[model samples]
Target chain A: MVEIRMRVNGVSESLDVPPWVSLLDVLREHLGLTGTKRGCDQGACGACTVLVDGERINACLALAVQYTGRDITTIEGVAGGGDPHPLQTAFIRDDGFQCGYCTSGQICSAIGMLAEHGAGSASAVTEHVAATGIALSGAEIRERMSGNLCRCGAYNGIVRAIQDVAESPR
Target chain B: MRPFAYVSAPDVATAVRAIGTEPGAKFIGGGTNLVDLMREGVERPGTVIDITALPLTGVEELPGGGVRIGALVRNAHLAAHRLIRNRYPLLSQAILTGASAQLRNMATAGGNLLQRTRCPYFYDGAAACNKREPGSGCDAMDGFNRNHGVLGVSDSCIATHPSDMCVALAALDAIVEVESVRGVRRVPMAEFHRLPGDTPHLETTLAADELVTAVELPALPVAATSRYRKVRDRASYAFALVSVAAALEVDDGTVTAVRLALGGVAAKPWRAYEAERILLGAPATEESFRRAAAAELAPATGRPQNAFKIELARRTLVETLRQLLTEGSAA
Candidate 1:
């Protein structure tokens, strides 16, 4: 057994999980953080998306022991005081979730996407990297968030929700 | 997932020693591919050496005008590096067209090259995969080969290397620096990944104890005009049907220098040496391009659903070459 201490959802949590247990499994089964859904146990689906050290990654593809000493931010931690984050509110306003199964992952992924954009990270669609802050285009947003899939076919609204947040005042 | 021992190596020396101490030990870099395989029972390692914390992340300029990328450098950082974007444009484009944004952030350079194929039969424990089980028959050959290999594929295995960065590195003449309990050695990109012949289980030339430390790219002049193109089922987040990474330099309507490599069509990164030989010093024309592409793909023996890859690869190479030539002429 490996004891790992990580800051999950703004709280310090410690658990002695088997070395092979994935972070997604620990979050859902052991700690009861089921908001991070698991669509496919493999890395194909983004339902297990979470932020480790302020970067989005598929928790299902990560071992919990490998994430020690990292600041973890899951979907449940995005909202404090039972209130929604601005991105979460925007996603709801835009009706981004049709079946609502991939919402948490989608929201967590979009927040990380915005952070990447803010830091001037370029996507496949972005032609210029040295150029200053990129203008968020629909194609850019779609390409950047392509890892997160919503089986409900709600990509259009999700794109719009992310675009709305990207355009909002910082 | 099965039970395993986990240890975090504080530095390179400890990491090297840990691998030698543990049996069936696998180094964990990004955990993007290894962890998924572990969950599916594909990899049953008795020990997992977490190598991510070691101070092995950087993209530094080599003394000889080239670049040395650390093994732990994230895919996103490697793709977005200033020199890589400006000089090695194909490398940047290749990494960007790979997995999604989140996966790129987590995927490391060494892990990306070492990732196993996404063959369904290999992942599904019920099916017979020569790669997963040595002596077992290959189900992909007789079954769904829509994503199987077309070049350098032996009867024993037909899985393709599922990496975009490696394809670009192959074209750029990159070399991988690896360390093991014994010592350190440098492996050229062309010889790093092995073609699955009778021993389908053996993927790379690196020994089990060897750990990839860095990838060194040789300096080149054609890198200024490099490009990477991929044709996939979807516009994004999908593996390539056929991808091309090319760096060309044409002078006075004649091919002065050309470096081309292919992905999603071979057992390894298909470096188009034959095609380069045909195009170098030849005039830039549509007919020459066709002949060159045909020469490069002559060894392509595709399965039923994947025969279209032959034509797609041909067109992709022709298109990329034409674009490069046109951009050169305009400049």
Candidate 2:
């Protein structure tokens, strides 16, 4: 067993996890933070999406031991204590989910996508690839969110929810 | 996933020593590919050396008009770096057209180059695959070989190298820097990946104890106007059925310089040296482009299922060159 310490959702947590255990299992099974779903347990499906050092990644593929001392933010971390994040509120207000199996991953991925856009990441469809940050258009959101698939086909609502939060005034 | 002992290596030398000592040891970077294969029972390493803490995550400019990219640099950071986007846009575009944003964030530059092929037969243990086994027969030769390969097939295996980033690197004439207990060495990207000759299991020239440190891209002013074209089943999050990375420099309507590479076409990133030969000093026109593309596919032999790839690759090359020729569009 490998012992690892990490800050999850702003809480210090230590555990003796199997070397084979993925970060997804550590978050869901060890910490009881089951918000990160395990649809594929592979990198292909983003159902286990979470933020590692403020960047989005597939939790199912990352080894728990590899994430020692790193800052991890799961769906639970999206809403601090009791208040829901603006993304979460927008997702709820827009009814952005159908079956909701991929809701947590979608929300986390959207949060990462926003941060990436804010940092001036460009998508394939962006006209000017040099622009630090491009306007979050519908195409931009869809292209960026392609990692998280919704078999329920609730992409319209998901896009609307993200767009609403993006255009909202701070 | 199989149970394995994990140790985080502090440096490249320690990592190399650890792997050299343990017969079943393998380096894990980001664990995107290794974990997936391990879960599938394909990769069964008894000791996984975590290399995340290794001091190899910097991207700096070299003295000779080139850039040195650390092996541990995440795909997202490399693609979004200002220098990459402004100078080597082809490299940036090639990486961006690759895996999803999340995968890109976790995937490392070195790991992406060493990623295994997505051949269905290779993934299925029940099927025959020379790559998975030396003497085993190849199932994709006649069984659903649509995505197999059109070049570098030797009846042993017909898998294509499934990396968009490597395709661009091949065109850019990048160099791979690897180190081991023996010594450090630099390998040109063109010779890094081996063809599916008799030994399909030996994919690269990397020694068992060697660890990739960085990749260096030599300055090619022609790469500034280069572009990557990937035609896949979907607009995003899909592997390319046929892709082209082309960079052309024309002087007075005659092609002065060109770099061409093809992915999803061969066992390795098929650098179009033959095509470049035909296009160099030739008039940049439809006929010249077609002739050059045809020359590259002259040695190609395809199965009935994958026969369409030849035409698709032809059209992809033609269209990519046409866009570069006329400055019409970008994919």
Candidate 3:
């Protein structure tokens, strides 16, 4: 077992985990932070999406030992000051999910996507990649959030919820 | 996943030494591909050397107006780097088109180059795949092979290289820099990956002990106008059924310079040298573009399900060149 230290949801935690234990397994099994769901253990489904140092990645693909000393933010961490994140409220208002299995990942992925867009990152659908300040169009949101899949096919509402949060003045 | 001893390398020398000393050891970058394959039982490394801590994550400007991208640079970071987006937009575009945003965030440049094919046979333990176990028959040859390669295929295997980023790198004439205890060697991007030939298991030129240090994109002015077009089952988050990476420079309606590479068609990124030869000094017209694409694809062979890839590749290449032409004229 390897001793791993990481900051999860603003809490510094240390644990001894096997080398092959995935970050998703560590979060769900060890730390009991089960909000980060595991849809496809592979990287195909974004149900295990989490933020490591503010960048979104699939927890299912990351080894727990490889993320030592990094800041990890999961769906459970999105809420701030004892209140649901605005995107979470928007998800509820827009009915952004048919089943709740993918909700946590969608919310976490959206937060990272918003941060990336704010940093002027270009998506596959972006017309001019070199342009500054990417416009958060619906197409751009869909393209950016394509990593996360909704088996219930609630993409319309998910896109709507994300668009609401993106258009709203933070 | 099988249990393995893990060692986080503090530097390049330690990482190389760890892999060089242990025959069962493998280097882990982002663990996006290696971990997945490990879970699938396709990759069983007794020891995993984590090299993410190595100081090889910079995107530096070379002295010759080119760019040297560190091997550990994450795909998302490389795609978003200001120099990459402005100077090598095709590379940026290609990186964005592959996998998904989450995968890209964790996948590194070196890891992307070394990623294995997504062929179902290769992943399925029950299926026979020479790449998985040499001397084993290839199931993809007669199985559901709609996604298999059409060029540079051997009877032993028909798996297509599943990277969009490498296709652009090949077109830009990038050089892969690798190092080991033996010494450092530079391999041109076009020659980095190997053809299936008789040994489908041997994928790249790098030995097991070598670590990819960096990828150098040589100064190529044509890359500025280049574009990558990937035709997949969906518009977003799908591997290419056929893809084209091309840069064209026309001088007074005559093609002066051209670079063409194809994806989802071969064991390696198929650089269309025949098509490039035809396009150079030829009229930059639809007729010439189609002729060149045909000449390059004349030797291509495809199975029943994947036969469409030949025409798809030709059309995609012609269309990409035409789009570049239009963009060039507009500029």
Candidate 4:
């Protein structure tokens, strides 16, 4: 057994778990935060995506013990108390998901993707590597968000939702 | 996944010591591919030595104009690094084109080089895969051989090395620096990944006690003008069906020198040495490109499902060289 200490969704939590338990399990079973869904736990499907220190990664492939001192933000932490985050509202408005098995991961990944773009990161489609704060074209967003898959074929709506937040203040 | 002893090493020495002493111990960085293998019951280690805590995360300039990339450097950071993107554009393009943004953010350079093939037969536990279990026989030899390697195929296995980063490294004359309990030794990228001969299980030449500390790319002006073009079923987040990494130098309307490598067609990054020989000092023309590409792909033995790869590889190489020549003309 390994006792790991980390801030999960803005809450300080210390939990003892098996060394084999993934970060996805720590979020879903250990902390009882079931918002992060697990689909294809081998990291093929991005259904278990979460933010560790503001960067998106597949939680299912990450060991909870390896993330002892980092801050993990799940779908629960996108907005703290009163209102949903801008991207969350944008997803609802644009109908980003159809069946919604991949909604949570999609939202969390979008949050990190926008943050990465704000930090002057380039995507696969970015022709100019040195250019900072790249123009968030649809093709660029699509390529960056390619990890999150929607079996219901909701890519058009998902792109619209991300674009809506890209132009917003939040 | 089987629970094992875990040690998070604080320094490089500690990590190397633990890794060298522990039999069946594996280094965990990013855990993108290794963890997947564990889940598939392909790899069961006695211990996992965590090397992420060690101070091996940076892209720094060498004494020469080349660059030294730390082993723990994430794929995203390496792609975004100014030195890599500016000096080795093909490397940057290759890294960005291989995996998704999230995976790239977590996957390390060392782990990226050691990633296994995406062959379905290898992943299937019930299937007969010589790479997984020696003498089991290859299911992909005649079963669902679409994604199998056409070049460098042995009777034992037909898997392709699924890495875009290494393909670019091969073309740019990069060297892999590895350290063990003994000492550090440098292996060229061309010789780092081994072809799937009789022993397909032995993917890389990395020793059990050794750890890849850094990948060094020598100074090459031609690599600055290099380009990588990948053809696949999807435009993003998929392994290459046929990828080309090309670095060219043209002088007085003639090709002075060239470095070319192909991926998704072989067990290792297939360096087009004969092709480059033909293009060097030749006029930059479609005829010359075709001749060179044909020389490189002549030895390819296609399967029933993947026979299209030969012509596709041919066209892709010609198209890339055409664009390179056009860009040079415009410049």
Judging by TM-score against the true structure, name the best candidate: 3
Pairs that collide in candidate 3 are none
lDDT of 2 by residue, B188-294 (tens): 99989999888898899898889999999998888877888898888999888889999988989899999999989998999999999999999999999999999
What candidate 1 gets wrong by more than 4 Å, as runs, is: A80-83, A129-131, B327-331
Query: Which digits, one per residue and each the tens of the lDDT, describe model 3 over residues A1-170?
Result: 99999999999999998999999998999999999999999999899999999999999999999999999999889899999999999999999999889999999999999999999999888877777877899999999999999999999999999999999999
DockQ comparisons of all candidates to the true complex: 0.57, 0.67, 0.68, 0.58
Tell me the TM-score of chain B in each candidate: 0.98, 0.98, 0.98, 0.98
The TM-score measured for candidate 3 stands at: 0.99
Clash number for model 4?
A: 0
Q: Over 4 Å off in model 3, which ranges?
A: B329-331
| Candidate 3 per-residue C-alpha lDDT over B54-75 given as tens digits, one digit per residue, 9 for 90 to 100 | 9999999999889999999999
Evaluate residue A140 in candidate 1 and report its C-alpha lDDT on the 0 to 100 scale.
93
lDDT of 1 at A51: 94
Lowest lDDT block of 10, candidate 3 chain B: B322-331
Query: What DockQ number belongs to candidate 2?
Result: 0.67
RMSD of each: 1.8, 1.4, 1.1, 1.5
Model 4, which residues run further than 4 Å from truth? B328-331
